[model samples]
Target chain A: MSASGYVQHYSAKVSDIYFIRPIKMFKSRFKFAQTKVAVGALLLLSCLPFAATAASLEAQLSQYAATAKAANPGFAGFSAARGEALHTRNFASGKPDTPACTSCHGKDPRSAGQTLTGKRIEAVALSVSPSRYADPAKVEKWFKRNCNEVIGRECTAQEKGDWLTFVGSR
Target chain B: MKFPTRPVSLGLLVLAFSALVFSRAQAGGGHYYPPVVDPVVKEECGSCHLAFPAAMLPAASWKRMMGELENHFGDNAAVDPALARKITAYLVANAGDAAGQRYSAKLLRGVDAASAPQRITALPQWVREHRKVPDWEWRHKDVRSKANCTACHADAELGYYED
Candidate 1:
């Protein structure tokens, strides 16, 4: 097959499976390398929205709690913890050239700040920033984009629920 | 179905992905994701730094990109059909509204079609979040622009933010 066809076939086939080890290991190391001052600053700034919508944050938190509980009844709480860890973990895959979520957003969700490049990010999980999580489409759009960047795949419903729980707990 | 847990399944997937990438290469391709730089855009617009993400523009916008080549930030880089087609396809496939719709946290809270083009770098909300950093910071000797999202966005290449 042609080169382009090869890539197409490979990506298609891989899509049929789950996460692989080598890819996971490579991602972890890459994540470690990206945690410098500048990138960290960018992460802080990127999470600014969390603070903007504190008013209704409580309601959203409750909703997340319910959703997460329903998604994984046995380990709803543990899954939240795992989701938190996953959010920050970097999967340095070859497809999308970017760092892990933690590379910019700090390991701690409570922190807010700037990035290495000066872009602002909100602490999405910290506050409800009335405007925060207000738009489901926008949230999904970024999740799709960011998930591909960090994990080289889409975030599973379970992962999303876990993430919601962790954010809600915060 | 649940994600593959078996080693054989994982291996098969890897091989499959590799094969897909290779075949894509042989079928009229150079780089898997080649940067589509227009000549005029290169001389004038790119003179400042890298051009904006192609995905920012739609097919209509891409056509505009070609037409405006000569006037691009002041240079002309009209791309031919074949290259443009490939570039356009990639861009459209991953356009801000298209690919981003799947997991954009911002998109999640709002109406389905709320933000037409979800360019995080260009979003007001995003800018407001990072406005405190100061433009000078983004223009650091090493940094590029406030819009040069790839610089700081943890998952820029994937096209959105994870944090």
Candidate 2:
């Protein structure tokens, strides 16, 4: 992006040295450059909202970590690897229709999934939708519903944390 | 292939009768159901499928369904207790048997609301309305689910059900 901006500025300077029609072309080029610069700024600016949510997401995980510590004296903390296993492994105890998260979410967390009713689910990977887990209420709602469906019970705080970590990294 | 005169005439009679009954059923032949207006209910219920019109079922149906969110048809759709209560209240209030839902009540014509029936699609009146739809239409790739009202009724989200 910066490289394109640099090239735009260089060409603009060269065009400025040329005459009448060149001035009009330079004006258009300058407008084009301005758009690129604004777009680049916007590209960087979009991360600001995600950054704010990133902090809140971390705080949410910390709360879960605290709960896990209370439940187990030797809690080793959340693990992305464990989260991945929990996501992929089919649990016999779970509802027959949804024995694993991958049953509906698919093997690729980065790709979309389809509900039994054929409604499309957005990709779960954080990289795909940076602000997905930003809303604590929505996050908790899905966790409550999905864990019960795929795990046959409410997931432990540790498991929730691990799952979040794994998916957030993706 | 004698033009199947008897069957064709019989089919026409059934069609004409339905046209009259359907008009009476939907109150002047409308296919609309007042969609859920409450944002909370819409969000919590509509996340997975069409937030079906509460007016399509009776109060008993809504009450029964809310009581079993843990096994909602096939998915664990349990919401927060308070939210569930709120949703139930809204649904029951607008249900087919509820006061002022006279038009919606037509859907419950032969149904025993006391049974607390669950499936809206299973409603006898609903079946009658869609009896003409081919099985292949329901199995179409984009129209895969019977829950996908919008697949045929483009304005289903807005409460209109005219195909």
Candidate 3:
């Protein structure tokens, strides 16, 4: 953030503080005796939105818990290592029509190339911003699309998790 | 001897003043609706994206984005009506608080006035430090953009260093 941006952010905070003060006062006045009840109700209401996010984060964590092993506990880096491996590992169908992930993705995930097949082989896992792959939905869409093209199957969450763990760790 | 109510009145006045300040502060982004996150949002949405740390955007941004799912960035990442309701509920629950800030992907995408690339990204001291690198090095199609510090910088996620 720039000096000007910082100043603006500060002003915005000051302005917000100025605003919420009145509402709190009014709430306290008529509801002084019922303050506990009122605050409890409001807190309950306030917490509703976060429930799903909490659930989502929990579910994701649980999934990780389920498959933290075999995938390699030391796969500690971003899931990019798996994604990198997946990118280069050639599938052995009757013959080796397609090469491994690295065959076209290049040895370095930071830099890869296209194949004769016209697929836009990009870096195994980009962590830059504007990030090349940050949207979870887009990641799923591609996984659905690419897994079929490359490995002829849908990637398991464990696989995706491993890939993300590796890539994000990077 | 009975004490006078002067101190009580003073406390009331102090409380009133503080309430006034608090209400004003709560006026903007703090006016959240509710989070509608659900199984669909968790599974389908979380597939490629960051599951959007709830506090990342103000309620207004979430409302705006949710209301327009059909054209969500040229894609329809919508779910069944019930699931949509659930997802919206989840998002509103964790929406941005005034003190914590509500940054959105769109906001972070460098489109908003505050996050615009030239103003925010390019002017960033870290970016400036790296800006010295020759265009050839950063723009190589191998990765494509010079802004991708993760290309060479190992811990781009932790923090941005001098260009």
DockQ for every model comes to 0.08, 0.40, 0.02
True contacts kept of each: 0.17, 0.59, 0.00
lDDT to native, each model: 0.53, 0.87, 0.52
TM-score of each: 0.34, 0.70, 0.28
Between 1 and 3, whose TM-score is larger?
A: 1
lDDT of 2 by residue, B51-72 (tens): 8999889999999999998788
Model 1, A1-170: lDDT tens digits are 69999999999778655567667888998887777766888877665555544434445445555765776676443366777887776676713334667765667777653444444466756343335465554556556655665676777666765675576567
Off by over 4 Å in 3: A1-83, A93-97, A115-122, B1-163
Q: Pairs clashing in candidate 2? A: none
lDDT of 3 by residue, B21-103 (tens): 88655543232222224556656445423244445454555666677765554334555577677777766566553344443
Worst 10 residues of 2 chain A by lDDT: A14-23
Candidate 1 residue-wise lDDT, B128-150, digit = tens: 56767776877674465555555
